[model samples]
Target: MNAYLTLGSVALFLALVAAVAVALWYRRRNDRRTHSLHQLLELADCLEGDLKTCRAGLQQAHAVMSLNPDLPAASEQEARHAIEAGLRSLLQQRIWIRDQAPRASQDQLDRAVSNMIETRSRLGPLLKALDQAQHALDDAMREHIIQRGPEA
Candidate 1:
């Protein structure tokens, strides 16, 4: 009878160990997922900020262009289209992250984050160029108005 009790005690101890192991494993998995989700959310926020800045720049450029009929608008139209496409792509990515991120592996999340960083970096220079172009257009418009006189 004492031997049976000992055996049962051993079995209970093993079961306790197994339960702890499973609990730890689940906690670690959840931690990893939380970290990945945080990183993706931060990246998405940065991208959204960049997109908003670009959109605003484009709007300012359009406003300046509207004041002058002679200013070429083909490039501005192209930029508008590109901005729209970027917005659509960003939205799709957010949806994907929401729906699939839990099931996605760490590697997949890392790749997605990397791609977003690359995209955000690329937008930096484009935004700078857009700002420069807008400034140049503004200067040209100012000169044109000045040379023609306010009354004319």
Candidate 2:
């Protein structure tokens, strides 16, 4: 009877250890998933901010371009279209994150985050160029007005 009791106690102890191990594994898995989600959310936020900035810059460019009808608008229009497309893509990404992030694997989330980072990096130079163009346009307009004088 004593041997049986000892055997049962050993089995109970093993079961408890197994339970703890499983719990730890689950906890770690959840933590990893949460971390990935947070990274994705943060990237999305940054991308949104960058897109907004680009949109505003485009608006300023448009306003500047409006003053001079001789200026070619095709490029500006193309930039506007690109910005709109980026916004749409960002929205889709947000929706995906909302609906599928929980089920998404770590590799998938990492790849998404990497892609966004690459996009944002590419936008940086484009934004810089946009700003320069706007400034140049403003400068040219100023020069034109200055050359024409107030009495004209």
Ten residues in a row with the worst lDDT in model 1? 71-80
lDDT of 2 by residue, 1-152 (tens): 99999999999999999999999999998898898899889999999999999899888878777877877774777878988999999999999999998898888988888898899899889878877887898888889889889885
| Candidate 2 residue spans exceeding 4 A from truth | 1-25
Question: Whose TM-score is greatest here?
Answer: 2
Question: For each candidate, how many residue pairs have backbone atoms clashing (under 3 Å)?
Answer: 0, 0
lDDT, residue 139, candidate 2: 89
TM-score for candidate 1: 0.75
TM-scores, in order shown? Answer: 0.75, 0.77
Tens-place lDDT per residue, model 1, 28-90, is: 988977887898889998998888889888888888888778887657778778888888999
lDDT of 1: 0.88
